[model samples]
Target: MQPILSLDGVAKSYGGVKALTSGALDLYCGQVTALLGENGAGKSTLVKIITGIVHADGGTITLDGKPVVIESAEHARSLGISAIFQEPVVFDALTVAENIFITGRPLKGRSVDWPTMMRRSREILAELDPSIDPAMVLGRLSVAQRHLVQIARALSNDARIVIMDEPTAALSHREAEELFAITRRLRDEGRAILFISHKFEEVFALCDRYAVFRDGAGVGQGTLQGMSSERLITLMVGRPVDQVFPKQVVAIGEEVLRVEALGRCLEYENVSFDVRRGEILGVYGLIGAGRSEVMHALFGTAPAETGRIVLNGETVSIRSAQQAIAHGIGLVPEDRQRQGAHLRLAIGDNITLPSLGRTTRGGFLSARREREQAAPLAEQLGVKMSGLRQRVEDLSGGNQQKVVIAKWLATAPRVLILDEPTKGIDVGAKAQVHRLMGELAAKGVAIIMVSSELPEVLGMADRIMVMRRGLVQGIVPRSEATPERIVKMATDA
Candidate 1:
């Protein structure tokens, strides 16, 4: 079958750095093609080039076997290509209907066709995503709903090709199912789908054919039929990644962190959990289920309306993150880029920021001590950088996450709280993080992990706590916890 879209000898570069070398990609009608790579391995650059967000330095692109010049995003869209980015690009003030038909609204003689737009918007959105209200503000909707709006916009434009970059990254299993359903509908309609994802399961489930990129070049390509998850990781990283989850089994010590009847106004209530030294307590919930709220409250980033927290067997008042840190509790928050790291700072500076007091003499940081302390931690975390002097901004998503982990680890907290720590990282980094978590737990540190990914929760947690709307649904031992039951509890009122 002829490919609906094809790139031949495509190449792009930034200064001396090659984002993508000469490479070929094909996406056929009624098929999904997954583009898999480690972050900075050229996947994003390739997508940008294909979508005309960035022009290729050298190559040829053919749509329906006809050479095309896609110089801008508008040109790409006009050529029937649409992309849903990793981070959603939607204006908060606009209604769903308005955003969907922003540029291409049906017109009636120099006047906006309000009635036609409303009717058509409702109809098109119902076909793509029925649950969303077209009248609702785009920003007011959940991440999943906004994603659907993006899809509706593409469909409304009559796009023959759609690119989804990490679409399932933030979605729950239920929301992902809806997305998969939409993908099938698009495929049946003969649209070419290009899927970019880190999760091997998602790739296997969605893509008919897939390509792997490594070190700025396409390394492998084939049907997903005979490919195993382990083999896929091996191809992407150029090394055998035998296991994705490297969970550790450490003997649980005495309870070091305890939450008693924790409640945050209108967010979470009566959330109670315990984490013993040398133990990992996993918190699982759908987005907006208040898991993050409870964690934030515990860490004192958000105030608790009513609750008591006992750490190291002492009842403590944590009014701020500094107080929590002083109490020997460290938190790696969900938004690492915004909250965790100082992007402009060097890798060593970020890693050592939390424990600078140890390297300080009379209120001044000892540069020598800071450098000496940070080097080992960065190395231990396998952070890829030229040296400690390299800026954090230049690192990949996985490496950046490692820097965040290194930052908190330097604090030597008795209890550690990680909120979506492995989020947006590659498989190799995820495994390493899992390994590090295990090592930290083994050192008698109590760990509380909040994650949306079921596999990570199941694999790493000594016990699982499932949360629903503003409440703890149930806590289960790892041996008894399964994906189905966890999902049920997470959605259960």
Candidate 2:
């Protein structure tokens, strides 16, 4: 079969930063091509080039064997190519139906066909999954909902080629399955799908053929029929990654953090749980099942009105995040880009921001002390960067997550609360983080991990607490926890 799209000697750069160098790739009709890479490995940059968000400096782009220069995103769209970004691009002012048909609404003669658009949007969403609300404002929808709208927008254009970047990063297991079904439907209809993801399992399950990217260039490409997950990981990282999960055994100590009858207005209620000194307590729930809110309540970001927080056998009232930190508690929030790190700041600056005062003497910063503290943590986290002076925005998604954890590690807290720490990170970096968590637990630091991924909770937790609709449905030991049991507790009011 002829290639639907092809790139020859493609290159892109941002000022002095070379994102892609001498790269080549191809997309064929009615097939799913998985693009694998580490954070900052230039995956996003390459997608931008294909979508005409950024023009490539040197390359030949051909559609259907004819050379073409896509001057802008509009030009790319005109040629029946569309890209769904890592972050869902939705206009908050528009409704879900409007956002889905934003480019060009279905028309009836001279007037806009509102009924047709709404009906068509509903049909598209039903094809994906029928739970979405068409009349709801885009601003009011969840991350998952916005992602569906973005996909619907691409389908509305009748695009022959579609590029999805980290499409399942924000989805739950069930939602991800639904998305895979939709992708297969698109493929069966002869649409070419370029799928980018960090999860090798998803890639292997969905892609007909896949390619690995390392240091801004394609490393390997082949059919997935006989490919092992191990081989793909080796190609992406240039080393053996035999195990994806890195759960370490540790002795559980006495409870170091405890909550009794925790309630936060209408957000969550009666959420009681505890984490021991040398154990990880995993909190599992659907998005908005009060997982993130529970973390906020514990950290004093969203104060609990009717709960007793006993830390190390003493009742403590945490009214603010500062008070929580002072009481030997540190929280790595869910949204890293917004709450965890300062994107414009240097990596070193972000790493030390939580404990700057501790490293200072006589009201002056100790630069030497700061570097000494950050360097080892960065190394341990395996952050691929030139130096600590590099801007956080320049780092990959995995590296940025490491910086967030490093910042909290600098605080030297007794109890660490990590909310979705490995959300967007790759398989290798995720293992490193899990290893670090084990090491910290062995050192007597209590850990509370809130995650939506079922496998993550099942693999790393010493005890699992399942929540459903603002209430604790059940708590089980890791040995007894299964996806079925957790899902039951998470949805069984």
Candidate 3:
């Protein structure tokens, strides 16, 4: 079969560092190709090269068997290439139809036709899903609805090739299924799809072909039809990963945290759980299951309307995040980019932000003290960077996650709440995080892990607390927990 798009020896470099050593791929019409790679394996760089966010240093990019230069994102879109990012871009204040037509509205006789815009938008939206109203404001729509709107906008552009990057990262199982259906329809309609995701199940379920990247180079490409899952992993990591989810059995100690009758209107109610020292309590739930909400309240990011929080058998009032930190609690929020890291700061500065007081000399911070504290944490976390002076934002997603974890770990918190700690990270990074959790648990830190991935919950948690619609359904021990059981608990009313 002929490729709709092909990139040969596409290369990119940054400050003498190679970002894409040999970026290569082939996207065929009527097929969904899974782009597999660890974070920093050049997948994102290749995406940028294709979309013209950045120009390639050297390569042959061919569209329709003819060499071409993608001058810009606008040029790529004009040439039937469109990308849907993990975070859907939409104008919140604008109507759904307005957002769809923002790129290029249909022409009317001498002026922008608002009515025709809305009408055409509704037609395009119906092709994906009809639940969204074209005239309705986009801000009121759900994330899933916003995704559909983005897809509708792409189709409106007459896009022949679509790139979906981690589309299911934040979606529930049902929502993911809906997206899969839409993706398959697009494939059947002869649109070439490039799907980038870290999930094996999603790739197997939705993609027809597979291509892997390792250390900024294309390592493998083939049909996924008879590919073993293990072989896929080996191709991605460039080596055998002995343990994907490394969990350790640790000695349980005194109770570290206890929550009873925790309540927040329209979020969660009557939530109760206990975390003992050296134990990981995994919280598993659907998107709106209030897992993050409960953790937010516990971490003091959002105080609960009513609840009893006990720390070390003593009742403590945590009115804010400062108080939570002061009381030996730390939270690595779900959205690390916006909520966790200070992007503009250096890696060392971010890691030492919470421990500023400890790094103070007289009345001001000591640079030496800060570096001393940050260096060990960064090294311990296996943060790959030139130095601590590098901007945290410049690091890849996995490295950024490491910095976030290192930041909180610098504080030496007795209780840690991690919300989707490994979301969007590579397999190696995920395994490293799991190993870190095991180490922390062994050291008697009461950990509360809120994750959407069932495998993570089952592999790491000593006990799983399943929540459904703002309530705890059941708490099952690791021995008794399975994907089916946890899913049932998460979905059942």
| Candidate 2: worst-modelled 10 consecutive residues by lDDT | 237-246
Which runs of model 3 end up more than 4 angstroms from their true locations?
A: 93-95, 108-118, 135-140
Query: Would you give me the overall lDDT of model 3?
Result: 0.91
| Model 2 TM-score on a 0 to 1 scale | 0.83
Quote the lDDT for 99 in model 3: 87
**Against the hidden reference, what TM-scores do the models get?**
0.87, 0.83, 0.92
* Candidate 3: C-alpha RMSD after superposition: 2.4
lDDT by residue for model 1 over 261-304, one digit each (tens)? 99977898898888899989999998888988888887788979
**Residue 199 lDDT, candidate 2, scale 0-100:** 70
lDDT of 2 by residue, 342-370 (tens): 99999988999878886688989888888
Residue lDDT tens for model 3, 324-348: 9999999999999999999989999
Each candidate structure's count of clashing pairs = 0, 0, 0
Rank the models by lDDT, top first: 3, 1, 2
Q: Each candidate's lDDT (Cα)?
A: 0.87, 0.87, 0.91
Clashes of 3: 0
| C-alpha positional error of residue 339 in candidate 2 after TM-score superposition, expressed in Å | 1.5
Candidate 1 TM-score, C-alpha based: 0.87
RMSD to true structure for each model, in Å: 3.2, 3.9, 2.4
